[model samples]
Target: MSHTLLNESNADQYRTRVTLLGTAGGPPWWDGSDRTGISTVISVNDDHYIVDLGEGWGPQFRKSNLGPVGFQKGLDNVRAVFVTHHHSDHIVDLPNLLLLAWHNGSDGLKSPIQIYGPGNRGELPPIFAPENREQLPEVFNPDSPTPGLTESAAKLMEAYALDINDRMRDNAKQDLRDVFEFHDIELPGTTGDRPNEDPTPEMEPFEVYRDENVRVTAILVDHRPIFPAFAFRFETADGSVVVSGDTGVCENIVKISADADMLLHECIDMDWVDTLMGPNSPKPDANLMQHMLAAHTSIEQVGPQAQAARVKSLVLTHLVPGNTPAEKWQQAAAGYDGDFYVGEDLMQFGIGAPRG
Candidate 1:
């Protein structure tokens, strides 16, 4: 199948399109709906950029129906990928996305798929004391550093070296190095400051990627102790859209999304989560609940944040209780009536278009 290449001359023919590829929060599972994990494909004409390659996103992308090319050819059309954080559910299919795209020969696939994300947190705080536990694990050590996106990608590539070698040996022209590129996001800083720390007290959005079709900016959000989770804004001539990549009620997202054409934000139904972790369940108690509150935004909070951001439309995605009926999430937009959408897998929204 012949793939259409997106370039400046024909850019006007296509309007920006945002597709909710996988709208589930925790992990990939079948719960009546086909929701996989949090993945969104933001396409400016034929240039497809994916944000958050969640678990099963590779398969989800194959079925997304974004480009003219069908099935595996569609995967090869992916221009770049942006990860919000290192959460397993968010990035479990990284290898699959990389490998499939590389192996499948699509036109204009020469440029390496650039993966951009936040750098590492220096060290992890001790989870448990040595004396308190029967067997102290290395993961609990305070001095051990959490790998950043770039480091993690390198490690993943290393783990898949044998498969990559075998494939390369079969086809001498196919090189893994030509298929992937990783970039670690860092804030401008002075001599003593950390590389990813903001230069000023007020955290602001910074440019992460730019191409013929769109300009992408990322702002640091408080998914705290998760250190640097980000919210991304993608702007094109048609309109601007913001994706809140797994965050709490974050001011950075509101700032980045100000007057955006649409805001795709994650929403959690805490009440439903609590019911799932009832007294008899094997789930962790108050601590887990506290973390949930700190890391994820409740449905009640979604409307207020969307209102504050003054976005044209609000689409709730990454549903925490993925199985909940759409009506159960409607009350989330009780006040500040704007265009509200209950995100479902494969749902497509056009940028700058009136809400349907």
Candidate 2:
């Protein structure tokens, strides 16, 4: 089926719409790809909630035109934020959002923008294939090796104390403490106890947040070693949208996304992984290659996963490598007949019927 491009001009028809802020995945600056980073926004009428704060999110958000026009008004309507994981590619620009909010109209925020993310892992993950290495690398922060969103934000604020103080006292900006609040999403008591042994246990989705406009639920996904990685489902009155944060094909994803209107999933190009890390490379590492494939869903795997969920539409975002040809990515439509789209930055998808 031909893909339909959704945008703001036709957004009036649906009660809820989602905009792709930046679709690129990973840390490397990909060749021949201008895609910024991985980020998205689910807008309900006038308010919007953001997911992930990847690199270049700030500029791309402005280009999206989701907020009101004029000075310092870009993030005025950002009601909340959800971080799927602690991957640098997914949250490197978080400082941009937190620090720049003062200059970007966070003062106009109706209430503190609630930020939610994974909590601290009580212990450090095991070293991957440790026997081969001569010596183990020293732990970076011994006391608090794996700080979660709440602690991470506190440290971030501490790091920027000089600048934050300069802005607040000299420029007379609103207290950032009053503008934002951070929360570490608590996992279900039964599961998530064994992070290294079983990072993603098969379990039903649980509520993480809810408001007047939408209810959000989360489930653990198989992004191994990177424990607590999640996939989020946003249910609005009009329809449901699920974001499959970085993960391999897992049953929990299909369970959370079951019957969702749209599933915005992450896709990796296995061929690229093979070329870079396969045996033919200068120094092949089988463990590294397998590790990459184990963490992300490939193009061939995504459609079947979407099919299993029975979603009405499947939009591919967080394109791995970020420079792969669109024609190659289109191959993902195989095995599924739903409306499939290769998401581009700033593109919008409205849910439910259009206005008369």
Candidate 3:
């Protein structure tokens, strides 16, 4: 099936559209790939809400022209930010947004931009392979190894105290605390009680935030060993959009994405994983292969999940390896009869119908 590309010229056709700021997944710089880290923006008219802050998202966001142009005019229409999880690839550049907003026009905001993310895991994850468990690695930040969004933001500012102080005292910049508010997304009662043992329990999606433009709901997805990893659904007057974040095939993803207009899900090429870590390689590690597959959805698996969700459109993002050919990723459309597209950086999609 042919994929219709959406851009700023045709943005007015729909009241709500999603813009992919960056589509690359993981920390490694993939060979021969120019894709940046994974980040997305859901725009409702002039207002936009960000999901994830992967590397290079700041530059990508600015280039997309999601907000106003001109000096100190960017990020002015940013309504909120939703973090899928604390994974490095998903949130490594959070500091860029938090620290640079002052220079990017966060001062003119009508209200503090609300930032939401998963709370602390309450404990560190167990070691992946038993063979490697003999030599335990030292835990960093022993006192607060599992700091949640609130603490993470506070510490980030603390780490940049010198620059922040100089900017506020000399340049007259306001405190970041006043420009943004951090929130730790709380789970429903008894839903995430067993985080380590069972990270994702079968549960209904719960409302996390609501405003005039959108009503946001979240469900726990299985990105194993990463507790509270979420799949978020944004419901607006124009249509609904679901972000699968990063996960293997989990029923919770289907639960949250049901009947959505669009579902942007992550896809991994298992062939790549097998080539790298499967038996017959220089040094085969079956445990490592199993662990990788356990945490990420393979291309063959993602289509079935999207099909089960019954979403109208399935756009794949957060591509594993980041350098895999587009045809290799197209296998994700196997079981899904709905529209499918391989996401690209700065690509935008208009959801639902045009206003009359």
Candidate 1 Cα outliers beyond 4 Å, as residue runs: 1-14, 28-30, 68-71, 125-137, 140-144, 190-201, 277-284, 353-356
Using all chains and alpha carbons, the TM-scores for the candidates as numbered come to 0.85, 0.97, 0.96
State the lDDT of candidate 2 residue by residue for 1-356, as single tens digits: 11235766776566688889999999999989999999999988768899999899899888777777787457888999999999999999999989988778744566899999999987798998899799999999898999999999999999999999998899988888998999999998768999999999989899999999999999999998897899999998778999999999999999999988999999999989988879998768899988988899999999999999999899999999899999999999999988899988888888876544
Candidate 3 regions exceeding 4 Å error are: 1-4
Which prediction has more favorable TM-score, 1 or 2? 2
Model 1 lDDT tens row, 182-249:
89887544321332343112466889999998999988776655656788999987788899988887
Model 3 vs truth, CA RMSD = 1.9
- Ten contiguous residues with the weakest lDDT in model 1: 1-10
User: How much is 68 displaced in model 1, in angstroms?
Assistant: 4.4
Candidate 2: segments with Cα more than 4 A from true spot? 1-4
Positional deviation of residue 139's Cα in model 2 after best superposition, in angstroms: 0.6
Top lDDT: which candidate number?
2
Model 2 is weakest, by summed lDDT over 10 consecutive residues, at 1-10
